[model samples]
Target: MHCYIVEYRAYAREHLDGRWPTYSRLVSLGKAIAPAGPVELWVLQSGARPGSDYTLLASKMTSTPIDAFDVLPVECPRDNVRETPPIDILITRYCSMNSKAELIALARRMVKRRPLGRLEFVGPAE
Candidate 1:
């Protein structure tokens, strides 16, 4: 896996909630973030280097997404029909913290710094 530092504009399209994405939408979004995978999605800013932030965000995975929830876990059998949630189902989800305000500020900063335009791919060099 590699680490990517992505600004909001480059990642805006991949932020899918529950809507079904059209093929063309997927194609365009895929092109925009060609080399970066979803390693770290920063909704808010710390103004720190991506190195410090990546560790903290990755820590979220240590706790399961369903922890403390009242929902029951079910197992699916191959012979039985797999069930899916209806499109209109209302399920609670978490958004990244202080995302709106941070994104707005980021846009302003990017205008001056072109920080959003910079995409860094750091890993074992080929």
Candidate 2:
């Protein structure tokens, strides 16, 4: 089995009004997919706000190490209405961005990791 890492941000919705499922929700989603295995955490970073320009860091309990990440930017309809752009769910699964190397190195690393695997789908966040 392969491991995964995921991050989220709000694009379509405004920062104050936008929303993303909680960590527990993600765990439940993972568990539903792979009932018998363990889902480890490499790193989980949720910004203070959509564009608050701040990051909140938490320590992992065990660190089994996440091999890849699947980030989904969800844009749900308000009052059962959908707009243009059709709510993009850009799915990019790649390795963790190393903090030491700066932006250029990080992008390079992401490119190298991309061909390894990719998964994109339209579904509700657990």
Candidate 2: where are CA atoms >4 Å away? 1-30, 34-46, 49-63, 80-126
Give the alpha carbon lDDT tens digit for every residue of 1-126 in model 1. Answer: 323323333245456444442211100011111122222222223234432221111111223431211111122223333344655875433223234444333323322321222323344333
| Cα shift from native, residue 64, model 1 (Å) | 47
Top candidate by lDDT: 2
Query: What C-alpha lDDT do the candidate models reach, one value each?
Result: 0.26, 0.30
Off by over 4 Å in 1: 1-97, 115-126
Decoy 2 TM-score against native: 0.21
Question: Across residues 22-76, which tens digit of lDDT does each residue of candidate 2 receive?
Answer: 3211221121111222322111334333322212111112355433443322222
Where is model 2 poorest over a 10-residue stretch in terms of lDDT? 25-34
* Candidate 1 accuracy as TM-score: 0.17
TM-score for each candidate, following the candidate numbering: 0.17, 0.21
Among the numbered candidates, top TM-score falls to 2
Model 2 clash pairs? 5-68, 5-69
Measured on C-alpha atoms, candidate 2 has an lDDT of: 0.30
